[model samples]
Target: MNAQTVIVADDHPLFRSALVLALRGLLPDATLHEVDAFDALQRTVESGIDADLVLLDLHMPGARGFSSLLYLRNEHPALPVVIVSGHEEPAIMQRAFDFGASGYIPKSSGLPTLALALRAVLDGEIWQPPQLKEAPAQALEHRELAQRIASLSPQQFRVFMMLAEGRLNKQIAYDIDVTEATVKAHVTAILRKLGLVRRTQAALLAQRLLQAENAALEVPAAEGLPVGEDDDA
Candidate 1:
């Protein structure tokens, strides 16, 4: 049988290294690839590496909130993604699952817990911390917004984010290394797909989605549950 391939995507060097070491201990025969930013991760995916899974960080450069997760879920529906984030709020965890994450691992989790969570996910089970009381439902508006964002082509998604950042078409062309005409075309498609009539409306909607996510993260950190143990363990 072939060994598994796992991509660890996180910007924090020290934590990423520790996670890699722990992953090595847990899956010694598996091939591991590391990327520090969302753009690097996108490049890795586009390179056709046949990764079995991706461990993604919630806050990474070139990605905002759940946009990265949405992009991965849209572009590669078969690939599994497990979110590893510092935020332990139940709402955030629930939101991750609602957005199609196979699992959510809080950064405070112990190595043993991390291993258990990975094992479950690799075995095709959706995993979350045992302390979660119930599944928090996502708002209907947020769900609709996510659906629209997920409908965009990968390049269109990038253009959408740049538009939200207030980058003009020329600036976006330079940053993405595409011609201005190409950017304009992407913008037109984005507007049509999102049902927005103008660029400013797209920007405002994107900002609204971002702010909603940021508010979820701003809620006081809930008390963390005991780590390294699951119901079946």
Candidate 2:
């Protein structure tokens, strides 16, 4: 049998090392990879490595909360991702599930617990803390937002992210190596698909998404869990 491939994307070396050690014990035949930044994580996944699973951290250098998760779900829907975060709040974990995460394991969990969660997820079962149940009303709103974000084509998604970064059409065009007119077309499509009129409105929506992510990151670290963490993949 082929060895399973897994990527652990987190910035903190010590925590990542501990997690990697646990994963190795749980998945003896697995080949593991580590990435400390979001861009590197994206590149690793996009390189077509046939990754079986990804363990992602939410507040990595290049990604904000849910953005990277949404990107992976949109771009590589088949790959399983389990978010490992310090924020074990029901709302945040439920949002992850609504956004299509295979599992949500709080950093406060012990290695044994993490192993059990991974085992369940690998067995094709969704795993989450019992307390992380979905709230229907809030779930509907988050699901709608996730769907809207996922609807963008790869190019359009890139353009949308650039817009969120406050890039103007000319700047976006230059970055994507497209003409400004083409960038404008992408912007229009993005707005229409998202049911918005002005670019600023879209930008603000993006900003709010980012703010939510930041807030989650700021959630007082799980009482005794290590610091330097937030959202997982």
Candidate 3:
């Protein structure tokens, strides 16, 4: 049988190394790949790597809260993703499961519990901490918001995040290698899909739903500019 391929996506080098070491002991025959950022993880997936499971970190660079989880679930439905996060809040774990994570392993979990969670997920079973309880109403709202964000096309999603980061259309265009007009078009589509009327609203929604701390709602200098433009298109 082919060895299972696992991708570990986390930004903390020390913790990521520890997880990889634990994984090595747990799945001795499995092939493991490591990525330090959410964007790198996305690129790994986009590279057509055959992966059996993904160990994702929620607060990695280029990701926040459930956005990466939602995006992965949407773009690669067949790939099982297990969130390995430092956020040990029950609500966060419940939100992870609600967002379609195959498993949730807190960073504080002991080796045995981590092993169990990994084994269970690798065996195609959902796994969570024993202490996790029923989902709260806030979880449902976040899940709905995630679904709406997931509805965006991959490009639109990228633009959505960039918008939240207070990036202007020209900056986003430069980053994504698209024209300013194309960026504007994506911004319009993102607004329409999210049922919003302005760029600031989209930015605020992204920050609120993703729980992104660094992203700010920047008002563009001109109403005609992309980041602050109204949904006239």
Winning model by TM-score: 2
**Which pairs clash inside model 2?**
56-232, 56-233, 58-231
RMSD of each: 11.7, 9.3, 4.8
C-alpha TM-scores of all predictions: 0.72, 0.81, 0.74
Give the alpha carbon lDDT tens digit for every residue of 2-63 in model 1: 37899999999999999999988898888999999989999998898989889999888877
C-alpha lDDT of all candidate models, in order: 0.77, 0.78, 0.78
Off by over 4 Å in 3: 61-67, 134-139, 167-189, 209-227, 230-233
Q: Write the per-residue lDDT of candidate 3 for residues 1-233, one digit (tens) a residue.
A: 23789999999999999999998888889999999888898899999879999999887887766788878987888899998877777767766776578999888889999888887887889997876745344434455655566678778888887776878888889999999899989988887776667787777777665664222223333345454453343
> Candidate 2 lDDT, tens digit per residue, 23-55?
888888999999999899989998979898999
Output the better candidate (1/3) by TM-score. Answer: 3
Query: How many clashes does the backbone of model 2 have?
Result: 3
